[model samples]
Target: MEFWTGLYLMSFLNMACCLPKSSYTVYLNKLSFSTAQSHCLPGSFLANIPKEEEMAEILKTIWDKNDKTATSFWIGLQKNKGDCYRKDLPLKGFYWTVDSSTQSDVKLWETEPSNTCLELRCGLLSVKYGETAATCNGFVETTCRQEHPFICKRNATVTCRRPDILGTHDIIDYSNDKDTCYVHCASGANFTLKCSKDLVWTVLGNQNMDTSQLCLECNKGYRRDASGYCVDVNECEESKPCTHRCLNTDGSYKCACSDNDMDDCDGSKPPTTDLTRNDYSNVNRGKSLLTQPTSLPDDVRTNETDVHIEESVGDVSNIIVPVIIALLIFIVLLVIVAAIVKGCIRRRTTKLSRRKAEAVALNGSNSMEKVNEKEET
Candidate 1:
């Protein structure tokens, strides 16, 4: 039994530690190769030219439906040899952005040699030319030229997640580790948050520790009061937000009503009045028509009656004003639509009448032409 239980627990823990989802997005803004690479900061780097099959997949993902024409794109392929005009010669090192792997078996270049300019050594990929080398700093406005849009590949291993902190609007940055995140605190201090690998966010700093090397002070359930000292939350000060009398304690507070009522206090209790229930009952006639009371109040039922009457008037006004405005708008739309339909009917009738008159005139001219031919014969 103990062996089976331990096995099940290990399986559960393994499932909980699955990898996060990965995503990649294309940017259309035209930028220089170096500048475009720098823009993919925080957690991503410039897209690296992948292996033959992988490059095809990446291009397929970024294939734009709106712009089907293949544009020039920058890839993470470059040679660092001082001599520029060497193609078959051994390169010092050709590497991807993150991984320093050599670009060997994947050959996707045109037949034309790339070193037309002595300074051209950067790699460019597109539909026409599978892969070609060019000057990294060259530029032109035309499509398929050196200056064009590029695709940036996201690092699949790294995932950025926002931290859950109260009263903080600062942006949180994610990293390779799932249990860690970078955030800015209320004191304008920037720090990396790392707890004991727990799911919940726990402040890992100690107050008694030295301040030189990243000290996190506050703990859960305690905050800096107005006097800048950490104090326990007060429950009885009505900030406990209890509806009735607040019972203060060391850690929390409890609420209880004098009449032993559990319902939320809506502050609608009636005030004392001289009139009896029957004398001023007629005043609440319109109000009771909407929401009838379930039971009777104890002391000042007359005051409660007036409160309901005012609420009914307010509700009726809110309903009536919107109905009137909607009716006016509907009438205006109906008039405009009717005018448009009438104009269309009038134009159609005029067109039919003109066609009939033209036909009659043609028949009359044909009869005259036949008479002239008979007279000549």
Candidate 2:
């Protein structure tokens, strides 16, 4: 079934789970550097000062509780005494035995030692003073000399003896402090089991309790469903958790840049600039159309009708202005044609009249010439 349809049903479902804190062990034994190194074997090493403030604070507490004398136990630091041909300095050779690391950032020192001194080599921890150099063969007096006691730091260990169910593969986690509460054991291909704080091994999908338990959300990017199973939550549908688009993964969601065309990420209604004309296609116009009353009184109807009439009149004027222009152009063409025709007729008439007058004058001159000839005879 779709998860969204069941969202209302499981609206009160618990989402948070509890986790256990990491465990640490401290051993207080008086021994030489080599003896102390062997003492913290199999599981732990000499206490290596941690970088975290909380861990440092814990070590300080342990130190405060046990510190009664000037010389305390040796920590992870051991003296690096090399032969005469050794090119490396004494401080350079010094390293942590825990992981063979030479990283030394946070150092508690009573008085900083000068590398010029060859005898003082191994690291020693004093209750009131802090970390300082001491001789390996016990030479320096009143400070850190002779064989002294030391502290060893080890991580609390947890082991799963057997699988909660038969034919199931077990996944173990002893690394994280927060992940100490539950262990993941897979049944079949998809389903998993979680061991809760109550020491009860409950299979996922078997609903006997309502309270949240660690590893219930077994997968990292998934959420627990009503069936008490871990499932991916489609964050894009309900919460709209992304700036642009939300992509759901195993137990987490990722955001992406929005597509082009419009800058709005939520895919909301597009913007409108001209509001004078009613466009019912948009949300704003639809709201305006819905909010107004359907029926109107006689006077209101009259006013609306008058407004429509005015609009119609304006439309008519817009159409009439172009038609009038076309008609004026046609009339001017006709007048120009008529004037050209009249001018041609007037020129033809004048030419015909001139030709007739010339013919009559020629005929009268011929008759006069005939009379003159008869008188001469």
Candidate 3:
């Protein structure tokens, strides 16, 4: 009894799941950071072969119960380069649904793609050139799109670990000790035994961080879903569409208008204090009504909300635009400088804060001495 199930493929292990296709084909060659974020599973995905083996068993159950030929598909199994690695696709085309990772047909990726650093793709296959990373939506070449078999990946079944471990594991090779693996429990599970990368060890049972949830894709802006990867959160989308100025941060975003911020601490609209403290009260009134909520009756709201949203957003953008520009300029400058400085630059930046603190202490001591002399006189 094999019925066609919509396939939702994940281009990368730590990215979001691709939308379930009515009839779609994915031959991933290079999934970018955004791809990693976008196609990553909803919760967490197993990045280890052992875990994938568990996942494959579940797949086998479904295939065994169904009456259909196995489809050609891709699974994550690349060489263990200290970077992202994807393995080659097996000839029969192994899908994530296959349960046996140890099968002879399983392909493995080549180990050494880099000379000294981490800057390439891994898993099903390795991208030869260096990372020219792009956003999730960006399009690139893929392997031939010949139809083989289909892969069906539903959300990880509610961790069957209630009787066992209730979450997925984030395994990092112990940096200090290669033999051990530092595991972290994702899904926001409240396990607080932060083990050093060296101290972290995997277990068939007992104590360790339960990585129930895999790293999830951050929302657009601040965290963006690039072509087939997860990227810096795109603050552009998270900023309330109703606000005038939107700025993105590492984990969150903010919105503002000249002389007033529409953003609150939690990144939501502000309270009356924010409104009353606004100095641009008159300027705000005279400005176009871009920030106004457009939930009015559909007839009265004739103008496209998108256009209005743009208009409202345009004003506060003055401040943010300069900041954005400045940030970009700064980034460009940093890149150029970095290209020149390389390892030295990285080392200096690491130690810079300490230098600044030391300078501040010396200045404070001099100021205190001067104050004491003046008081004595």
Candidate 4:
């Protein structure tokens, strides 16, 4: 029992040992690369590229300081799941990012392990439990509590220069572990910060905070979290006016209603519209009787019709027999006139031609007789 108790105490001590009290105040705990962007220099190649040798060295240093040799630390080298790219040369840095320098070497691609290619960065596996190789993505069941060696870095201290206490919610607290603080923020609580090095969290916006942008209020609909994030207030039920559709946005809610209406005003009906042949779809703007009344267009045709009924009556008023008789008489008179005119013209022209012929014949006979007398004498 005594031996077990001693072991428990030692385990507790180790859990709290050598860990930085405040990461925000120190530089060693600063974040450079995560499961992603583990390799490559600051802003080089890409935010990706995991450095293997350096990561291994960090773990080695950690183990040395702890006076205990660990089997493995989570490394950022994932398997080469990129098909034929796996066979490409110079196996270094992060095999996942395909670092700019190595991309040219990729000639053929082979099918990658089903789960290998998708990760932004690979996890390092412990050499003791899993193989040093075996495609280390920390797959197959490994967690962070394994006491593997880890690397640590300190970040430059941030000081808030301007002090403002808009409210209790305006303050952001500084912590040794910004990652932990961020996690707290993700859980729906914001950090309350202060300016002094002692790191008391009660201070409002400290006069020393340099970045005013990062120091802000949780917008109207959102509330702050311990991690520094503004979480959305769950307003799916009432805050949204769009009863038809409620969409959850970053920090607020939105209501969306469909404009198309088929027939009945049933909100629950879907995939079908309610509309009549002559009725327009929208309930607010259906066919107005004032514009298109149920009456036929002919009922309201032009009302200025003033046809002369008296003229039609007068045209039928003539005595039938007398009118026909008058027409017959007029026709006979026209025939008689035409015949007389023709006869007169013919008689006149005949008389004139006959006289001309007779005169010529008589003159010829007289001249002949005179010629005979003169010859006999």
Candidate 5:
């Protein structure tokens, strides 16, 4: 039996036993058996009546046409010239052209063939006896060269509905054939699905729908490994963006300072006395301090401690230098004011002395004048 036919009978109980009623099409134009077979190509083939129910369906179709001129029709059953007859076989060495494995136990032949070993024979269904016959069995064996109207069978086109079980970043695409579907995931992975002839959808490689395997590009702070799995990215090992310490998380990273007193991870704090002493010792040992070292021994000073010491010394100098300059400026102004006061005192003393001398000279002149006037009188 055909795969679709068996599936319909076993799984889809609502459908007909063999091919569905809609699957068959009758062509009234008469043509040879080979020509008829060729006519149903690309998507269909000649009808295979492997069961009596299918033959009854074909007969009903012919009766519905109500054409008295139509008497016989070619089916898909045929026997090659070189094939030997097998009496024990259900089909007697004959096979359905559509599927050679098809078999039937129901005897629908009108009469047994006289030459059982004859070849190049094809199957035909005749209704000349009577349309209302109880058996409706009119299977006839005839030459391939005979011209007759034939029937073709094709599977109904069925669409596999889109699956809603996809991630937000997943994409779905249908192929030109419409039977194939491809799934693209954000993690740079892909899977395939196919619409089977029996109207069923199946995954191509039995792939699971897990998001871990479907993603192509991982989320932030995550990366794809060699085995195509999304793994956590260790930013601390790769870029070392932290100044003191680094910690890795599920999808991100964090930085931390070794000193508990420090508010941030940048190592920004004043150095203690021990740290200052160690910094000087390291400086005396002739170690280059231009670049900050990431790590140091217990005895040696760390670069962060050195930086704190340098900053503290710089801050002290920045304050003391300005105070000393202000004191010097104040002394210079005091000396200039004292010199002006001393010069003013000397000028005042000199002016006082000159006034005293002039006054004495005037007194002497006055006394002499008085004496001379007395002598004259």
Candidate 6:
């Protein structure tokens, strides 16, 4: 009896561990690749056969289905936009739709009827020689617009199915070990779920707990209303984060300053200068102040230095204006003095010449008188 119980336990454990990781479902309904993908949404996705064994398994599954109309079935392999062909590489730039990181098995491609990646192409497994009775070979490239029967794949583990209690807005995340599923709602509420070995989902330590009680927390910039839905929180009315004017946005608030109070509205002080404070004593200060170490911040020091430079330029201009005026006055006075001295010299030379001429005439008159007296005697 003990041996029989041990054998039964071992068989159960072996069956549990040997369970397939995924399962495939073939849909004979002809549909485009996009439509087929859409049909597989919410839980499953397009089939991905990454290994030769998996491809063989899928082909065997298709053969077992015995669909007389399906000549080819769409797979998850597709050449996305901007993906060109590479003659040296396997799969020729095609990627699996479910997990692009998994490379397609190189042996799962046929050699005949070679195809090129000239356009957006999707992949499908074709029946050899177009015979429905024939087994499917490797995949072949075809346009995505072509209608064909498709295969969808989903996780086949004994784990619980993903819950949909939180509606379409809920995001589900799995742990690295894939033992725990975390459901996060847009309303900022979070719920924890675990799959037991018995194929049951336990929600927050209870198997049949009310999900409405899980949505208690609110997200940032949102608040729960009376209807239990998350609504936008008016930060302008509630928090008043703005200094001057507060404008409410969808999930945030904008702060604005008036034209006159443009400075310091964003919680930063305005740039200041000595001239703005009407302190002229430091107008002639030298660069020594800059060379010396100070306790002021770098930005403050930079602003003060720039202001000092501007004020120094203005002071230099003030001194230059007076100097220019004084030079002009001195030049005008020098010219007038030169002109007066030239006029006086000209007058003195004229008077000296007239006196000499007068002396000469008087001497001639006296000589004439002496001559007349001699003639009379």
Tally clashes: model 3.
Answer: 60
TM-score of each: 0.36, 0.30, 0.17, 0.21, 0.36, 0.37
Model 5 misplacement above 4 A: 1-22, 114-118, 129-135, 157-377
How would the candidate models be sorted by lDDT, starting from the highest?
6, 5, 1, 2, 4, 3
Kindly report which residue pairs in candidate 5 clash with one another: 186-216, 186-217, 187-215, 187-216, 187-217, 188-215, 188-216
Q: Give the per-residue lDDT of model 2 (tens digit) for 234-336.
A: 7667677765555665555665444333333222322222122232123233455346635433334344455567678899999999999999999999999
Given candidate 4, what's the lDDT at residue 186?
A: 29
Per-residue alpha-carbon lDDT of candidate 3 for residues 1-377, written as tens digits (9 for 90 to 100):
12322232323532544422121123233343334323534423312223434334434432443433332233332222242322343322222222435334323423333332243232232222113321111111123222222222323332222212344545555344333344444533222223222223223333442333223433544321212133575546643542455666666666564335544334354222232313333323443543653533342234344445666788788789899999999999989987888978788877855655665577787755665565469
Clashing residue pairs, backbone N/CA/C < 3 A, model 6: none
lDDT of 5 by residue, 25-83 (tens): 78899999999988876456888877777777777777766676777888888878877
Distance (Å) between predicted and true CA of 229, model 3? 36
Report model 3's TM-score to 2 decimal places.
0.17
* Residue-pair clashes per candidate: 0, 6, 60, 42, 7, 0
Model 4 regions lying over 4 Å from their true place: 1-166, 169-216, 231-234, 237-241, 250-252, 258-377
Between the candidate structures 3 and 6, which one is better when assessed by TM-score? Answer: 6
Worst 10 residues of 4 by lDDT: 298-307
Candidate that scores best on lDDT: 6
Give RMSD to native, each candidate: 30.0, 22.7, 35.9, 21.0, 20.0, 18.4
Q: All candidates' lDDT scores?
A: 0.52, 0.50, 0.38, 0.40, 0.66, 0.68
Q: Output the worst ten-in-a-row residue range by lDDT, candidate 1.
A: 134-143
lDDT of 6 at 220: 74
Global local distance difference test of model 3: 0.38
C-alpha lDDT of candidate 4 relative to the true structure: 0.40
lDDT of 1: 0.52
